[model samples]
Target: MQTEHSFTLVVAYVDDLLVTSSDSTVITILKTALNSAFTITDLGALKYFLGIEVSRSDFVQQLSQFLSEPRAPHWSAAVHVLRYLKGTINFGLFYPANSGLSLEAFSDADWGTCIDSTRSLTGYCVFMGNSLISWKTQK
Candidate 1:
């Protein structure tokens, strides 16, 4: 943590730590302190965490739909997904301070797209000005 205007956020899960702050020097100091006390590793930038790839936008939510029960018809789609996933390996979200704080959201559902069921997939995307703030896809 720094002064009231500048603060650092650290998320610790088990032994791993994800640290972020507006100032890079603060992050460096925090990491050095943690390493001296706990012998921590600096993994540089965050890539993969838990089971999530930690990149891209709402594409994973759509991908989850096919995982439930993949059929032969979705094979080509799967291949395309592999390519798309590869391209997004370096993707990350960035929201500038100048971006206004206007909260807007939109959602839609694909009614009965499941080949073997009547269920639908619904998804919503929330945006703050030009930055994407939240998104999810669910069945």
Candidate 2:
């Protein structure tokens, strides 16, 4: 583990290594250290991880699009996902232990985000006692 960037975070039952900062330089340095300590498999960027399509938000409504792709076929996706998990085995989403306890959910729809189908995509998420338990978005 690198003294500079080695860290751990937990999201639900998943474990993730929280790299220091979002800076490319820091991430590079950390990746180097990680490679030295163990076999390294780079999934490139923080695009899709563990079935979740991550989108960074700037405000409550305005969300910046990062990347999104159709869910992989269950059978084949497992191998790829597993390899990704192994590579990022130490990384996870971290919620403060002292954070407030609550359960909430939100739903939204896009008029028509699917160019091929000309159909709208709808998505909703359920938070179990505050942490996201289930979510799905599809056209």
The lDDT per prediction is 0.79, 0.61
Mind giving the per-residue lDDT tens digits that candidate 2 earns over 48-114? 5544466655532221121233344543555665687799989765656775557678999998767
Q: Estimate the TM-score of every prediction.
A: 0.38, 0.34
Give per-residue CA lDDT, model 1, range 1-139, as digits (tens): 6687688888878877788886788898888888788877787777876433466456656665787798876667778888987999889888798998787989999998977777899999988778886799988
The residue ranges of model 1 lying beyond 4 angstroms of the native Cα positions read: 56-139
**Candidate number of the best TM-score:** 1
Backbone clashes in model 1, listed as residue pairs: none
lDDT of 2 at 72: 41
